[model samples]
Target: MKKICIALDYNPNSEKIAAIGHAYARALRAETILVHVISEAAFYAMEYEPFMGYDSPFHLNNLDMVKELEQGAENFLLAASLHLGTDGIKTQVLEGETSDAILSFCRENRVDLLVIGTHSHSVLENVLMGNTAVKIVRHTGIPLLVVPTKMEG
Candidate 1:
C-alpha cells in the first residue's frame, strides 16, 4: 500500500484514531493524509438569516472564519504527524458534507486504505443525525479501517 488516508473531526478522540492510523501507515511503509471537512451548514451559519420570523443574532459577514478553521485543521494534522514521527504527512481541509467529502477524497486520491473513527453517540442522536461512518462504509469501495474508542476495562 502506498497511501493511507485518515478522516479527522473536532472530537478529541480523533487524536487516538490518528495515532493508530500512523502506526499502521508506518508498518505498511505508506504515506498518510489527514483530511477534515467543514460542513456547509456551519459556513452558512456565519451569515445572518431570518428563521421562523426571527433573525439569528450570531451573524458575521467575515469569511475568514472558514480560513481560520482550515488553518486549525492543518495545525491539528501537523501535530498528529509529529506525534507519529512520520514524514511527508499531507493534510486537506474541504467544505461539504462530512462523509461525502471523505469518500470523494479517498476515491479521487486513489487511497489504498482509509482510516476513520466511529463516534460514541446515543441511540436517539444516532438515529436523528445518521452515522457518517456507516454512510462511508456503504458508499465507498476503498478498504476501510474503523478504529473504535478503547472500552473501559
Candidate 2:
C-alpha cells in the first residue's frame, strides 16, 4: 500500500492542506501521516536543553521562555491531531529544522508522496527569504505536492 506524508505547521491554512491530503489519500487508497515539525529555534526558546547548569541569568530566563513556547507547541499539536483525527489521518509531531525533519521522516517512512503548503510570497521575497517548499523540492527524492494557499477573490 502506498503511504503519504503531509507536513503541517499549525498554520491557518492547515485545514486546506489536510483536505488535499484526504482527497489524495482517498483517491490513491494510501495511508496518511500528518507530520508537524517544531523548529529548533522554537525548541530552544522553549528552554529544552540537556544540561541545566548554566550560570548566566540571561540564559536561565531564555530557558524559561523556551519552556513556555514548548508547552504551547505541544498543546497546538495535540489539538491539531484531534482535529485531523476526524479525517482519519495519522499524525506525528517532530522537532528540528523543518526541511530536514520532513525529509528525514519521508526517508525513514518510505513515503511515496509528500504534501505541504506554501505561504505565498513574491519572487524577490522568496529569494531573499528562503522558502521551505523550495528547499524540500530541491533536497528530497520523493514526489512532492506544493499546495498554494487559496487567494482571496
Q: Write the per-residue lDDT of candidate 1 for residues 1-153, one digit (tens) a residue.
A: 999998988888898899888888989999999888878636544665678888654466445665666678778777777876767899888779989989999989999999999987777987999989889989989899999874557
Best by lDDT: 1
Candidate lDDT scores, in order, read: 0.84, 0.79
Best by TM-score: 1
The regions of model 1 sitting more than 4 angstroms off are 45-58, 150-153
lDDT of 2 by residue, 1-153 (tens): 399998878678987887787679878999978788778745344434456675543346786766676677666656765765555667676778889999999999999999999987889988998889999989999888999985778
TM-score of each model, in listed order: 0.86, 0.75
Clashing pairs in 2: 45-66, 46-66, 46-67, 47-66
